[model samples]
Each structure stands twice: as structure tokens, then as C-alpha cells.
Target: MSVIVLDKLTKDFKNGRGVFDVSISVKRGECYGFLGPNGAGKSTTMRHLMGFYQPQSGSATIDGLNCWRDQKQLQSKIGYLPGEIAFPVDMTGKNYIRMIAKMRGMKDLSYEKELEDFFEINPASELRRMSKGMKQKVGIILAFMHKPELLLLDEPSSGLDPLMQSKFIELMERFKKAGTTILLSSHMFEEVERTCDRIGIIKNGRMIQEINATELRHSRLKTFELECEEEADLNKLLVQFPKMLYDRQTRIVRISVPDSRINELIAALSVCRLRYLKEEKHTLEEYFMQFYGGKSNV
Candidate 1:
């Protein structure tokens, strides 16, 4: 069953600055990666889900509950980490965490401590004194403390170091294994690629593409980079595969071959003296580039 659904959800902020006709469904136990560059309406869509803003058109729902109408009821059912966090400067991290927990009527904090230990953070310092990374750790702890069935994470690892980022990915993988549904908006391609089962790319406040992560990770079309011993050898190979991309200076040729044509490619390469050959795996970023005009702005 779909745990979250955004049906033609449009929230126009005038001059094309908000989500438009954005439609996506995240199934139960699924992690849906929301990909886009900055100001592409990812955060806007998430806000609608959180009931922070009512959509001008269409609707957002979680487990059949109307997001705007049932905002109060859904608050405790979801674990949300916003793109930007505003901390109470006067409160210590532990105090802030306690305050949120008190609002939710939570008694057990065993999971919270576990998360703190895993993230390697000491949340006893005042928010005003904490660094950006430390504040991010607190946000992560809050999001995961309740262990909600659904998680709405916007750039969850934003201020995290490389080590902490990997740790966050591992945490997502762990949650996914435990049947948690996630809507993750992120700029980090590696984390999204590692944890997401599917991805949706938004551009100009619209969902331009939705793709299966598995298909992208294991694409049938394979690109082989070949370095020929001689320029003549490279030229000979190109004659058979006219569409092959090559660098004349390096005598290196790059060709995309389908699995069915692998034998044919081998046969063609057998006639040419090649120095080296390796297949280039297709990545989510490469596929996503087509939507962003070839540059990885994300």
C-alpha cells in the first residue's frame, strides 16, 4: 500500500517558484529519493506534506489522512527533518530534545541515546554555542527518536562530515530494512543512490522524471572505454560502430553496447589491437544530467 501520496500537488508561489502539478507516491517500506538543485521546490513539496502550507491545487496525504486537515494527528506519526533548522539559542541540545519529547509525551529515550552514540555527538551544549554539524546531529536524533513509520528528511546529512554522512546512509538502510517509508530530499547523489529504491527529479518546480534506482544501477546499456594500441586500430573499430565516441589524440574510444550486442562488440574488438578495455557503469547522476541540461547542479 502507498504510505504517502502527492496527487497533482501544485503550490504556485508566482513566477514559477513553487511545485507545480507534482505527483508522486511512496509505497510502504519504500525509500523515495527526491532529487533537484537548490530552489527546485523539493522543500516546498515537503512543507505541504508537513501541513505547513496548503496547496493551491491538488492534495497531499499520508496513510489516507489529508495533510492539511489532519496535520495535528499526523505530527506524532511522522519523523521530519527540515532543510533548514531553527534552534532555540537559550536551550541546550539535551533540553531542546527533552522539550520536543515532552510535547510528544515520550517517556523512553533509549533509542535517542543510541542515535547520539552512533552520531558521536554530545548534545549537552547550548544551541547558540553548538557548531552547524552539532546542531545537525541533534536534528537527526529528533527525527529518529520516535521511530515513526514514515520519515520526511530534507538534506538530512547537510552539515555532516564524510564519516557522518556514510553513517547516515547506513542508518537509512537500517530503517528501510525495518519497513520504514521515507521521502528523502537530498543534494548528495551518493547517499540517494545508495539508499533509495526509486527517485524523482524535479526541475523548475515540476517533477520532470521518475525512475527506478535498480534499473539505473544495473542498466542493460553498458559503456565500454577502449584504448587502442594504434590510431588505425581505433579508426577500424569506429568504422564498425560509427556512433562510438572517441578521443583521437588518446586513441581511446567509448561505445555504449547493449547486452544482446555484447558478442557483436567482442567480435568487432577482436579484430582491433586494444591496449585496455573497461565497462563504465551507468550512475543515477548521469541519467539525472539529461534533465538538468548536462550539468550536475545538484
Candidate 2:
């Protein structure tokens, strides 16, 4: 059975800004990446999934149960890490974790202690005095301590350093290997590409694209950048490759073509003397640009 499902889920706010008709599905042991710019309804959709907000229309389900109606049951089965956290202003991290554990009816905290050690979080300090990174670590440890079957992480790596981000990815990989289903939302392409099986791109509160991670990695489309020995060489190449991006002053031409047309591109470049010819590294950034609007970038 699909572990997570959103069927035409719609939530409209009073200001006419909200998610509309968004649908997605995630299977057991699969990691689904949810990506969108800031205020593009990413957080709104997550909130609905977590049963924090009731959907005005449509539905969200996890393990064949309604997210809103069966939230109590769902909460135990899933662990959620929100984009922003609200910690008690005066409570120390040690006390706060203890309080949560007590509320959760946890008698044995061996695993939770392991999480604290794993993340290098110092639970002795007060929450207000903790750095952003330390707080984020605390959040991550709390989310994973329960060892839930499904994870709903919204910008899980926010405020984390690059080394810690890499650790987060490794932790996720371990979870994946253990047959955990995850729905991770983030704007970081590298992190998403590294951990997710499929990526769903949202724009203006609607889904704009769904791409397979492996297919993206081995895509037929490739971009190349070339610097000609002379301006004439560049001009000659431009005539043959009309679709190319070129700068006359710099004598540089950039073009994207399918792998099958590499011979054609090579043929066109052969007639021109090239100063430097190299294939540009293609990242998910360019792939995401088509769906990313300028109004809000998150």
C-alpha cells in the first residue's frame, strides 16, 4: 500500500494565498522530496498533512487513514520536524527533552540519549541561549528518537552546517535501508537529490513537475561551454548551432543538446578552432529554475 497519499488536497486562506489541488504519493521505504520556493504553500501542505490544519477540500492519508481524522494514531506512526520550531523560552534543553519524554509516556530513553550523542547536542544549556545550529540538532534528535515508521521532515537541515548536513543525509540513508518511508521537504537540491527516490516540484501552490532521481542523474540532455580561439570561430559555431547561448565579446558559446546529438555538436565545433571545450556540470538548480518563480524564492 502507498504509505502516504495526497489526493487533490486544497486549502484556501482568507487572503487567497494557499495550496490548491496538490496531489502526491509516497510508497513504503521510499523517500519523496517536496520542493518549492518560500511561501509557495510547501509549509501549508505539510501542516495539513500533519493534521495541524484541516483541508478545506480533498484529503491527505497515511497508511490508509485520514490524516486529519486519525491524527492521534498517525502521530505515533510518524515523526515530524517543522521548518520553524517553538521551544519553551526559559526551559533548558535537558528539561525540555525530559518533559516531552514524560508527555510521550516514554519510560526508557536509551535511544533518545543515543540521538543526543549522535547529533553532538549539549542538552545542558537553556533553549534561549542555544545557537541556531544547536537548536536544529535538538530538533533532529527529537524527531528521530521515537524511531517512527514514517518521517515528515520540513527543511530538516535548516541552520545546520555543511558537515552536519552530510551527517543528516547519512542518517536518512540508514533509515531508508531500514525500510522507513519519508516525505522530506526542502529547497536544497543536493540534499534532496542525494536522499530521495523521486522529487515533486511545487509552484504557486500547485505541482509543476515530478522527476525520478535516477533519470535526472542519467539524463540525456547535457550542457556544454566552449571558448573559441577567435571571434570568427564562435560566429561560425553559432551559425551551425543556432540554439546555442553565446557572448560575442567573450567569444564563448554555451549549448544544451541531447547525448544522441553530441556528434552533431562535435561536427559543428570541428570547423571552428576552440580555445577551450568542456562540458558544464549540470545540477538540479537549472532544472528547478523553470518551476521557481522570482516573486518568492525559498
Of the candidates shown, which would achieve the greatest lDDT relative to the real structure?
1
What is the C-alpha lDDT profile of model 2 across 32-63, one tens digit per residue? 99998788788898898899999999999998
| Per-model TM values vs. the true structure | 0.83, 0.79
lDDT of 1: 0.91
Expressed as tens digits, the lDDT of each residue in 47-149 for candidate 1 is: 9999999989999999999999999999898999999999887999999999999999999999999999999998999998999999999999999999999
Once fitted onto the true fold, the runs of candidate 1 whose alpha carbons sit more than 4 angstroms away are 220-282, 294-298
In candidate 1, which residue pairs get closer than 3 Å at backbone N, Cα or C atoms, i.e. clash?
none
Best by TM-score: 1
TM-score of 2: 0.79
284: Cα error in model 1, Å: 1.5
* RMSD of every prediction: 3.9, 4.6
Q: In model 2, what are the clashing residue pairs, if there are any?
A: 38-298
